[model samples]
Target: MTNMMIYNELTAICGENNVFIDEPMSHHTLTKIGGKADVFVTPQTYEQVADVVRLNANYHLPFMLLGNGSNMIVKDGGVRGLVMYMSHLSSVRVEGTQLTAQGGAGIIHAAQIALEHSLTGLEFACGIPGSVGGAMVMNAGAYGGEVKDVIDHVKAVTPTGDLVILNKEDLALDYRTSIIGKKHYIVLEAVFKLEKGDAAEIKEKMADLTYRRESKQPLEYPSVGSVFKRPPGYFAGKLIQDSGLQGKGVGGAEVSTKHAGFIVNKNNATAADYIATIDMVRETVKQTFGVELELEAKIVGEDLTETAD
Candidate 1:
């Protein structure tokens, strides 16, 4: 579709405040990186988002459903479709021991809401940076707990743009993957099952987790958390450190001096720099350890330069 047509149709479907033409993708991402999208939409409600999706599908135009941009990297060339930010979809409610939360809600927010009601089980999500949809889609976990442990059911929009509900068993949750990919469902809301617990104890666990994160991670720097996935029997950081690659980088993107697993922006790094650093890490680790290092975070869009220094 033409730019004018895309704008006209989107504006007609959603109000002016809900859409942007050629929105800069960097501002929407957690890594403070990347380029721009042809168009961006922040639908005011789930129905509005669904309407946008249905309309796009009808036209056969490209569209990408975005969460918090926690687990993705939009490339320097940007995305070639309508990028939707679901932050405004956030809502949370409690029904007895179950918490029903919108996908846009962060897991930490859910954990806090659970803590307020003295609900346990979400204490493991204390510092997870992704949204509930992000956490659910990837089964995001930390400190020995995962989404599969508490999720009950999910309401979502399927690939064909129809809404559907799936029980916990249907998600096929595993290490950082879900049925959302195979089933192509865009999560709208999720219900979590939790047990009653002491509010003080729950807070204590969250605090402890927060302390550990602050002390161990290079939180002061801009990064995407762990850059590489753990190999079968070896941690990504340990292998990187053993291979003598800590603090190495391409341009301003460097493997953090404080933590080997993090590739950080040391001096205004670009998306190219980040990509270069990642490539070097992958190649170097494979050469040194004889094991391929897989990326935990998703890299999207296209590199403006085929070769970035």
Candidate 2:
């Protein structure tokens, strides 16, 4: 099938206004550094999302799902095939102690809703910058709390566009990984089982966590949150700081002076620059500390060199 045919089909599924060709990924990602996507579609409803996915499967075209884009970096050459932006699906509701959020809903917003309902479990997620779906994929955690602790179940679409409900046990959520990504499941919604607490206490806890995050993280500059995962027996930030790599970087991407764990876009930086800086940090840390640093943030798309070819 031709590109025009694919565009028309997608437009039929998600409306003409929701579909775009050669959309800039930099405008969507948190790092503000990426190339364009071949095609982008924003499906407003669950049925539309499933239809788009089914169409991609039928066409044998590559498909990628994007949530808040908080912990990801896309390469300069951009992504091929279809990119589904899920922001339109965002919705949150509270019933008693259960808080249910759509996949595209901001995790921070979910925490705020929890606070409003005097729920306590989501206080730790008040500072997380990703969407609920993204958070569920990585089992996002902070300050000794993780999404697995509160998630009751998840509704996800299989790669073939069939929807299924996965209980907490089925999720198999670990430190920063989950079965969802491994199985290529698209999260539709999540039910969080929270406990009732005092509204004042929940608010205070969120405030404290927000303060700590602002004070410690380099939030002024655009970044993909923490770059590397914590190695066994040591924190990644401490290792980088101790290795004298705090102020070093490649291109406009610099290891944050405020937080050694983050590589920030201090100026106009390309995805290539950001990736190179990540490589530099990993190599230096491995050489200095003899520990292999694993990536916590995800890197996607293609490089400029590849696109040129």
Candidate 3:
């Protein structure tokens, strides 16, 4: 299918206002880096998302599902085909002690809702910037709490554009990964189970976690949160610090001085610079401790042929 034909079809479905051509990815990601996407799509409903997925399949065009782009880095060469942003679908509701949230709802927003209802389980996610769907896909967690602990089930559209409900057990949530992510399913909504708790205590706990995050993380700079996953026996940040890689940088990308786990855009950094900085840290850590540091932040799109600074 030709580009014009696909564009016309997508416009017919979501309207021209929802579709963008050559959209800059830098504007979407937290790192403020990356090139452009050939086609950017924003679907406001679950049916729209399913339709978009089916359209991409029919056109033989590849598509990427994106949330708020918190833990992802798009490369300098950008992305081909469709890049769907799900933020417009955000909606949250509560019933009794259960909370159901649309995929695009921010984790922080969901946590706040839980707080308002005196729900106790989601306080740990109060500081997460990712959408609830993204958190479910990655089993995102912090402060000794994980999404898997409270997730009751999730509704998602498969890559083939079929919507299905999966229980928490079927999700196979582990440290930073899930069946949804592995299968490239587009999450529509998630149901979380929580207990009624003292609102005051929940607020206090959320406040403490937020303070720790802000004080330890390089929140002032643009970054994709933690760059590397925690190795089995050691923390990524401590290892990087031990390797003498603190404050090291390539171009405008720097290993955060405040926290070695983060690679921050201290200056106006390119995607290439961020990638190079990650590589440098990985290699240094590998040589110093004989540990292969895997990345927590997923890299997507294409790379540009440019000299690294």
In terms of TM-score, which candidate is strongest? Answer: 2
Tens digit of per-residue lDDT, candidate 1, span 209-294: 99998898888887887887778999999889888988889987999878898888777788889988999988998998798999
Candidate 1 error regions (>4 Å):
305-309
Estimate the TM-score of every prediction.
Answer: 0.96, 0.99, 0.97
Model 2: colliding residue pairs: none
- Candidate 1 yields a Cα-based lDDT of 0.86
C-alpha lDDT of all candidate models, in order? 0.86, 0.94, 0.92
- Rank by lDDT, highest first: 2, 3, 1
Instruction: Superpose all Cα atoms of candidate 2 onto the true structure and report the RMSD in Å to 1 decimal.
Output: 0.8
Name the better of 2 and 3 by lDDT.
2
Check candidate 1 and list the clashing pairs. none
Q: Candidate 2's residue-wise lDDT over 1-309, tens digit each?
A: 776788999998889999999999999999998899999999999999899989999998978899999999999999989999999989999999999999999999999999988999999999999999999999999998999999999999998999999999999999999999999899999999999999999999899999999999999999999888889899999999998998899899999999999999998988888999989888998999898999999899989889897
Candidate 3 lDDT over residue span 1-309, tens digit each: 666677788899898999988899999999998888889989888888999999888777878888989999999988888899998989999999999999999999999999999999999999998999899888999999999999999999998789999998899999999999999998899999999999999999999999999999999999999888899999999999999999898999999999999999999998889999999999999999999999899898888753223
Model number with the top lDDT: 2
Poorest stretch of ten by lDDT in candidate 3: 300-309
